[model samples]
Every structure is written in structure tokens, then in C-alpha cells.
Target: MSIWWSLHLRREAASVPLARRLLLGTMETAGVDPDVSYDLSVALSEACANAVEHGGDLHSGGASQAYRVTAYLDGEKCRIEVADSGPGFPAPGPGSAVRRGAVPGAAVPAVTAESGRGLCLIEQLADHVQVSNRPGHGVVVCFDKILKWREGALLRVS
Candidate 1:
């Protein structure tokens, strides 16, 4: 069965875990591999947390002021996207092959900061990760995970 969901959440600290829990529940009910679900949940939490921390304009709930999380599940593969409404990341240099916004495990200049490891953790956990900024609107973080079940499981997707 195909399962999907989308959430529009206030850009607050409390919303981070809420988003994670929703994803976990969705994956569990859909019979996803536990380890894969866990990794995706962690990655989703980090992405949501990043949106809360840097998406900006939390006090206002006006249009284009909240963060969005969307998840899609089809058989053994799951894709999730967390988008925000803010000024967005800086433009990538023309000569650069991949935009900083769409990079995987890209070195963050704010490594010395208290909480700059989200993207790195996501890259380590998710099977695929892509980030892109919407020029003055916001940033979108898209990630995917492929589930693998242990042998002898009752259900396995080819």
C-alpha cells in the first residue's frame, strides 16, 4: 500500500519531536523496516530542527511563515521533504557543480557553532539527500531511505 502525509507546523522547538513521532508512526504502520524507520526519523528530526532554528519569523504565523514536512511511502522506499519559509541559503557560485543548498555532507562553515551538525547527521543516516533554496522564499530538504528486511520476515518488498 502507498502511504503519504504532509504537515504544516509552527516553527517552534516543540514541533521537532512531533514531526519525528508522526514519521515514525507512519513508517511503523506501513510495515517498514525498523532500522530504516529509525534512521529516517532521526534525519527528519534534524531537518525539522534546522527549519525551526534557522527558518526565521517564528512569532508570526502568516502565510509563508510556517514550516512544512511531507512524507511519501511506496513499498520499501520512503521519501521525505521538510521545507521552510524564510530568507533561504546563499546562492551557489556559478562555477560550483552543486549548489551549497543541494549538497550532501557539505562542510558547514558554522561547524564551531553550538548546533551545526544537523546536515552532516542527515547525510550519514539517509540513503539520499538533496537541499535547495527557493531564492528569498525558503529552503527545502529532501531525503529518501530504502528499507531492507531481514531474511525470514513475513513481508518483503522486491
Candidate 2:
């Protein structure tokens, strides 16, 4: 049977570490290799940070500014999902204003200066990254990584 784990936390930046810990623990329990575990942890942390910074206005909802993290192991792949509670932004398109070398008119220079590289890093680490708006609420980032199976762990057929 496939194993699934989930966590929900505030969208505050401080909660990023907590989210990473939860993801690491879940991956360890599922027998994920250490290298794969590290990659997943870093990618998830970056995604959470992005959601908190740009997904919506956290102060408007006060303590309600929270995000949800869910992870699961499906055979040789690990799946992770992070959902936030704010109006979502458009998915960054390749060579788009936000991603291109030029700064977009819509983005505030200060915020971009601090954390704009998150999506770029996520793209590098994760095998697949998907972004979508959570109907009526915020945005969801889903990512998947292929797990490397260890040799000799499985019995050979005669």
C-alpha cells in the first residue's frame, strides 16, 4: 500500500522550517534515499516560502494565513503538495516577465529582491512542478521526484 503524510501550518515565514522537518520525517519513514530526501526537503521549503511571500496577504487574515502540506510515496515516486490560503498569482511562464532577465512592472522590486529565486531553484531540484489555483482560496504547488531504489533490497527470481 502507498504511504501518505500531510501537515498544515501558518503561511508565516517562520513555519518554513517546521514544514521541512515534517517532509523529511515522512520521506525517511517511507525509506526514501538520503540524497532524494535532501532534494525534496529543500524544494518543499522554497515552495512554502514563495507561497507565504506572494500567494496572498497574510496580515489580512491574521492567524488564518496558513498553508497545507501533503506528501505521499507511490511506488518509485514521491509526491508533495503545498496549498496556501490567499488569492493565487499566475503561474510563471517560461521567458515571462517575472522569469525573464527584465523586471516585471507588476512586481515590487523589494519583494523580488528578497525571494525571487525560489521558483527557479524549485525548477532545478524537482523533476516535475505544477502550480494551480485552489478554487475560492489560494494556490497549490505540486511536485514529484523519482526515488532511487536500492539494489539487493528486492529478492531475485530464480
Candidate 3:
């Protein structure tokens, strides 16, 4: 069986939890393993939070902008994507840590830093992560995880 959903949400703090809850509920209903669900939820939250915080037009005031979150569960993996309308990431340089669809060897934010840790966390939690920019459009954070099902999952894969 396969399951998928998408949500377009305002870039607000409250929307973060709402998205997380929806993903968690979906995972629960599909009988995904609790730990796997938790990891994905957290990753989702981080991505949502990033979008809410940075996915906006600074000159126009970002609060009024919106972002999108999409989730897909098929075969043995689950994929989630968060796309925001804020200014996309700056063009990467030769030594830049971020690439087209992955952030291999990305640096972790300093302990005292209040931000910049979400991407690393997402990369760590999800089996594969892609952080890309749409130039004058926005940024998209996409990640995928291998799913594990409960013994009697409602949508168990054979």
C-alpha cells in the first residue's frame, strides 16, 4: 500500500507543531514503527521550523508568506519535502558545504548558536537528504527514510 499527503501552511511557529502532528498521525495510522515515526516527525518539525523562520521575504516581512510540506510512503521508504517561498540559499562556491541534493560533510552549528542546526539534524535522521534552492523562488528541503512496520500494520507491505 502507498500513502501520500501535502499541506500548504503559513510560516508561523504554530504551524510547525500542526505539521508534525499530522505526520505523526499518518505514521501511527499506517502502523509505522514508533521510533521511525518519531524520527521523521522531528525531522519534519525541524524542516517546518526552518521554513517558518527563514522561508520568507525579509524585505516584505516573512510572516505573511507560506510554505509547503509533502509526504510520501511507498514500498519500503518514506519521503518528506518542505518548500518555502523565501529567498533561496545563496549560490554555493567551490568550497561550499551544501550541494544540489545533499549536504555531505556539512558543518554542525556551534553549541552557542541559536540556529543552523536543522539541516544537519535532518541529514542525520533521514537516510537521504536534499537541500536545494530555486534561485529567485525559494528553497526545498527533501529527505527520505526507510520505513519499518509494526507486526500487524493496517497497511503492511508483504
- Which candidate gets the maximum lDDT versus the true structure? 3
List, residue by residue over 1-158, the lDDT tens digit for candidate 3. 99999998988799999999999999999999999999999999999998888887645865338899999999889999999988776664565454223644444455798888788788889999887767677888999999999999998788
Candidate 2 worst ten-residue window by lDDT:
100-109
**lDDT on C-alpha atoms for all candidate structures:** 0.80, 0.72, 0.85
Instruction: Flag regions of model 3 displaced more than 4 Å.
Output: 58-64, 91-108
Best by TM-score: 3
Candidate 2 lDDT, 1-158, residue by residue in tens: 46787787877788899989987776666566779889999999988887778666756775347778898777788888988877666545555444432222223234438556766666688898877765457777888898864444331111
| Rank ordering of all candidates by lDDT, starting from the highest | 3, 1, 2
Off by over 4 Å in 1: 59-61, 91-101, 104-107, 150-158
lDDT minimum window of 10 residues, candidate 3: 99-108
